[model samples]
Target: MNIAIGCDDAAVELKNTLAKHLESLGYEYTDYSQPAEDESNLYADVAARVAYSVAEHKHERGIIICGTGIGVSIMANKVPGIRAALCHDVFSAIRARKSNGAQIITMGARVIGSELAKTILENWLQADQIDPSSLPKVQRINEIEDSILSKSE
Candidate 1:
């Protein structure tokens, strides 16, 4: 599956590590990360880019990173139809996809090491299909999103 990956300056190293891991796993991915020197490269912007890419079906999934992962997760979820989950463990990563049908996963560079991040990504990748029983829950989530969006419009 093609993956969209991005990070802010604070998580550049972790992003690089994950990029290499994706390569080793034979998964095709595109990096949307901005140069560290770019003063306008905000975490929220990068997160939105990745989130929109996945939401538009430009990529199958996405991985976004920041110092604490919280900023990116919040920003990504702001986009309609995007379910971005901040996951620091393998179980959360798996459940993000299997239970929530999340198309994007956020990680914290300062919170987890490269090895653990790789392990989490591996498990998340393996969980390509959501649990069948979670369909109703996922549908409800979509309905809620649509409701909120329609109200705002």
Candidate 2:
């Protein structure tokens, strides 16, 4: 499957590493954001581009990165039908796909080590998406999220 990747300055290094991992996994990707992060980099643009690209790509998956992964996740979620999850471990990453149908995964450069991030990505891609009814964790989280979403609208 084709994947879209985006990252700000703080995550450029990690993003590059992920690119290699994606290549090794035989997944094609398009980089919407550049490699440089000096002082002028803003994650909003990168997040929006990645989100929009995923929307446009039709059935493709994506990954986004930022300093804490929160910024990119927040930005990506603002777009319709974009379920972006900020994950630091295998369980969250795997469950993100399994329960939420998350199209994009965001990782924090400062929050997780490369090794852990790699493992999370690997499992997330392969794990069976759990049924919403069978998993209370998934059901409750989505319910809470939906409540918040309803209030926001």
Alpha-carbon lDDT, every model = 0.94, 0.83
Provide the clashing-pair count of each candidate structure: 0, 2
lDDT of 2 at 118: 80
Worst 10 residues of 1 by lDDT: 32-41
TM match of model 1 to true structure: 0.95
lDDT of 1 by residue, 68-116 (tens): 9999999999988899999999999999999999999999999999999
Candidate with best lDDT: 1
**Every model's TM-score:** 0.95, 0.80
**Which pairs in model 1 have colliding backbones?**
none
lDDT of 2 by residue, 1-153 (tens): 888998998998888888899899987888977634553358988998899888776537788989999999999988766789999988889878887778899999989888787888888778656666647865666787778789989
